[model samples]
Target: MNDGRRKVLKAGVAVAATLGIPFVARAQSKPVKFAALLPLTGPFAFAGNAALEAFRDATEYVNEVKGGIGGRKLELLVEDTGYDVAKGTAAFSRIVSRESPDELLFVYGDSTGLSKALAPEVARLGLPYSATSFSSELADPKTYPTIFVLGPTYSDMMAGLLGEVRRRKRAAKIALVYSNSEFGKDPIPFAKAQAEKLGMQIVAEEVTPLSMPDATALALKLKQAGPDFVIMQGYVLTVEPLLVRAAKEQGLNATFMGTYYSAELALMQRGGPATNGFVVTYHNAYWYDSLIPAVEKIKQFRASKGRSISYKTTYYMGSWFVVDVLGEAFSRAAKAGKLTRAGVVESLNNMGDYNADGLIRSMKFVNHRLPYIKLYRANVQDGRFDAITDWITVG
Candidate 1:
């Protein structure tokens, strides 16, 4: 048999041996339903489209190996949340009512607000949801439990960046700009606390909607604030160019900074010279780092499919994490002789410190969010984010 067929057959045989399910016989059975809620249309569509591609690819990978847990196929159901809270609510309702997926995977929310709105309902239905939002409020053990975040939380990323500022004794003056959303609003309290503790001056703060028609005026306004550095809480398109250009036009020499989502390769490319000397924080090690086993496998997987990994895309790693979590849950459920939603949840709860080939920090469910977030400092050089620190972890 060829290598591809042999790999699939081996995977099938291993799963069958573990679950004691007839491998070849049950391979053609109906797939277990899985749903993904992402913003395919509306404000956050850029992020949504990226995440959807990742989700689709990962699900397809699992199926290529003869289905997933219990020899059951994985059926992916996708719904567009439109980056609206009400639309998100309705889309979720439809997914639950119509598709009735066994698990929810690769959910994308714009900020803490929408995540909060949906957290209660997802838990009420006992659905296992993996999402992109990483606000610390969701980490509260009392409030949310069904939600699992796969990336570094905003709080964690901020702490890492701030720590570097302190280490370098560069806390002279700092300003803030944010999108008017749950994500934008989330860091106010934490930023206040951290800034005070670190003795960093918060010179000015500004907010604008996610899809603002005129950030040029706001960008000009930000330049007038006159701080030594500016930290932007925005996605790729919203932050890099607008703020950087304004800083230049106004002749403000403050260092530029951004959070995880805004650190994508597209931002650096589009921002051009403006992105130089700007620092942003991220969680995952650069996928281009082939030394990491899981990252290497991901590269190989893409190459095998006749596609080259692009710097503009890394959400595939997020989807890979989703599958890794599911695989852990599936293995546990199979060992226990049942593969129900509750069983999967139980397995997930008990999954401790999963490193997934050390591509990221170990994932641990603390309250409703994954507690282990690792931060990497990177600057834009030649249109890509280059890691500065070896790795930084949060409290």
Candidate 2:
């Protein structure tokens, strides 16, 4: 075997010894199932695959180092949704039907549309569910008691970004460029309201497909509008690079910023020189933040797969965060002698100041969402985004 695989096997052996269990017996226990609906074949395939890899690494860590949740290994069940709401919902239904709800510890939805579509059903079934979406609607604990959001809502991130813009450039004229989807349009209304409240002018609002044939038209439109800043939403990797390149080529001199989904390493690598000075809002620290012990651990695990963690995208970090949060909830529920769906929800509700091993700031849930946000600027020379501001909490 390769050296990395040998190291991982050695680590597993050490963990089994520490737990006072034979390695074979430890591997034989029933597993806690986690079902994930991912868009592995469509526009967001890159992000889905990254998230799946992170999930796999985290599950392996849990089963090895952590001895699993309450002594049970984690078995991940992933289905490809192709970034379609209908396909995602159907996949979720099929998975849940096949797996016992008790065995299935939690469910993860890959898109905002999928999350919204599955919310009612998840609530009806009283199954604990989380999603990659940052939609404000999912933060409603009263409406969807069993659902959890891993980070700030899109509206909150927009508000935080606008707050930063106002701080740097008072009364800035801003344009909103987003994808034509539920994910893209989720925060527009709230953003408009917040912009009005903050005295920032809404210069232009443009919509483009998630995968644009060309961003020339939109870039020219933004140039004509003459906004001081442009905020991009509803994209993982594709549209941002094209839009930024087209805008720069058209001589559009506006500062570009993006929400969580658009703030990814892949964007910088793809956009190249155009990504210089690009700013983004995010809740978690990037994989390069080795100061975070969890990030270091992730790097080691990723190396076992013959990959570098620095190439990981924001979706990858978000997926690992979800796994960490779920592991914490499972531990808490097991301690309370109630390792069930209701118990997990209660544990999640009671959690406070969790930082996911320093990958994020001390996060607290308010209205079922963490209200923290941070700003980062792409350092093109280093090909990484460096934080420009500390955690900013939105009200």
lDDT of 2 at 250: 96
RMSD of 1: 8.9
Model 2, residue 16: distance off in Å is 32
lDDT (10s digit) by residue, model 1, range 144-178:
55566666677767777677667766565778788
Question: lDDT of each structure?
Answer: 0.67, 0.86
Collision pairs in model 1: none
Q: Which digits, one per residue and each the tens of the lDDT, describe model 2 over residues 24-64?
A: 57544667788888889977788899889888888888878
* Pairs clashing within candidate 2: none
Q: What is the TM-score of each candidate against the true structure?
A: 0.83, 0.89
- Give me the displacement of residue 173 in model 2, in angstroms: 0.6
Worst 10 contiguous positions by lDDT, candidate 1: 100-109
